[model samples]
Target: MLPWIFIGLALFFGVFWFSGNAANILIIYVIGLTGMGVFLVLTSLTISKQSNLLKKAFETEKNYPPLLVKAILLFAGIGMLFGSIRYWQDVPFYQDQNFSVISGKPSSIDEYNSKGTVTELYVEIKGHTFVLDADMPQFPKYKKYEELLDKHFTILYLPNSNWIIDYKVE
Candidate 1:
């Protein structure tokens, strides 16, 4: 039981550590490897004694398949499915993202501006210069952009560079 608790904690931390960021390729790769490792570990640990115990418990209608096991299995299945789909579909994480919302082009930042505490950035996507405003509708506060925002957000670019909303400090 203690070993199982330790293993569960390790797994939780492992997944949490990899939760953020946009390295889709690297994330997929690491998770794939880690998942295989976990599966192998679990399989090796499931000895004949454990199987017999489970069978007997099941036959007696005892509580052998604990909630922990069910939860772990559920999470593992979901994670594997999500990772495989992301890899196969080439889903872009927030950091690896290079898409320009303004011109619908692939490009990098060209210039940026800051006025009084407000900031704006411009990136030439495809071949057009789209404004990046910290207060744009596509910003985190923008309802239209909620689904677009993933867990990690450092690489996000906002357009309409001059639309800064100001509030009184008092």
Candidate 2:
């Protein structure tokens, strides 16, 4: 059950990563920290129980000492805490108010294809390169790439990840 919960949390976070919305990063960071705290509390409770349900469920022949379990949990918690702190540090850059804007005709437009499908799009304008991920809401359709050519565009983007948040073609 805990594994499933972790998997669900991972999937939830993954969706936000693929969304290409800078503002969502701070939300994910907060949720991730909360989830890690919950995980640590639950793990501590489970470890304290005499029967050790997790060990029984795994059906391990070797009876591991409680100290070992606690140590392992501690290490895991520390790793997760480190990750959360790192995410927190990046939150400011992902905020919507920090978005940078670029406006001009694209000096070059490139598409990276994989297995006969366009997977990533790169547009360069005024010496700055911006990426339009396929999962991004602002990602133009494949057919629209041609239309984008020869047009001036104004793009709002996250500088850290070079992700396009919003774009307007003129």
Candidate 3:
């Protein structure tokens, strides 16, 4: 019973740590690793405590159902591991993001993306190739943001990603 309480508290704290940064990939990865660590610790503690209990009480209590606990912990630990793997794959690229301002004409303009209202506009910046979200702050600066197919522009990208931090119509 005590061990199960400890395990529950650990899992709760793990979620509390992640709730604040649910949108942050790196934070999510850290939480996943931490949650798995907590699960392992609780499992070991439960095993040790079970051995120390008197025979009759141990037999009667059957306190924590081993199979049920194992299944729950295994499910949570595996879920966290998968999250960590996804974020881990991006770590190498994130470390070497280019910081220079780049310029080029978009080869294509994607209109009618349904992100918010059935297909918003997007511009594929030639140099970076990632479609910059047309609804971003810089959209108003473009005379007709969606008409970027042939126009040239300078774009600032967020480090290590295709996301445009800002843009200038040249």
Candidate 4:
């Protein structure tokens, strides 16, 4: 009975997290629910209790082990607290942001040999569309735009300090 209750609670929390605005919260909720569900199922099947009590808990009224509830609560509370903290610190999906253009123009064949080890991305944040600089210098190998990222590409510069480029589609 207790296992079922925990499972229901996990499902309820899971739904709320999925509907919320925070992506991190959704991730944590999924992990927490899955972990708790597994724990409850295992406990329901394994706890050595009097057959009569077990029957009463399951056949008549739903009841669960207090220790199990305590453990689940503790784990869930910690996860929720941590996730909330992270959500507060991260940038929301809706934000006005921009990306820096490193390459002056787009090139058919592009080469970025730079001194800075880049981790952050520069984007032109106008409303929702991210106008990637066609010619971004020192672009990251993994995240560069696909269209303007061939061995050879053309570089175009927008008068507004943004660069456009034509590179290999691959």
* Candidate closest to the true structure, highest TM-score: 2
**Prediction-by-prediction clash tally:** 8, 0, 5, 26
Instruction: Please state the error at residue 133 of candidate 2 in Å.
Output: 3.0
Q: Candidates ranked by TM-score, best first?
A: 2, 3, 1, 4
TM-scores of the models, in the order given: 0.29, 0.47, 0.39, 0.28
On lDDT, the candidate that comes out on top is 2
Q: How close is candidate 2 to the true structure, as a TM-score?
A: 0.47
Reference-based TM-score, model 3 = 0.39
lDDT per residue as tens, model 4, 54-116: 555555433355445445655665555554543333323112223222332233322333465
What are the runs in model 2 whose C-alpha is more than 4 Å off? Answer: 1-26, 29-90, 93-96, 135-147
> All candidates' lDDT scores?
0.41, 0.63, 0.55, 0.40
How close to the true structure is residue 166 of candidate 3, measured as C-alpha lDDT? 59
Across 69-126, the per-residue lDDT of candidate 1 in tens digits comes to 5455546645654544433333243245433232233345433445644355454444
The C-alpha RMSD of each candidate to the native structure, in angstroms, is 13.0, 6.3, 8.2, 13.9
Task: Give the per-residue lDDT digits (tens) of candidate 3, residues 41-160.
Answer: 565446542443533544655646554455566666566656556445545544565434777877766556465552345666644465544445555343454566667778765444
- Model 4 bad stretches (over 4 Å): 1-13, 20-64, 91-170
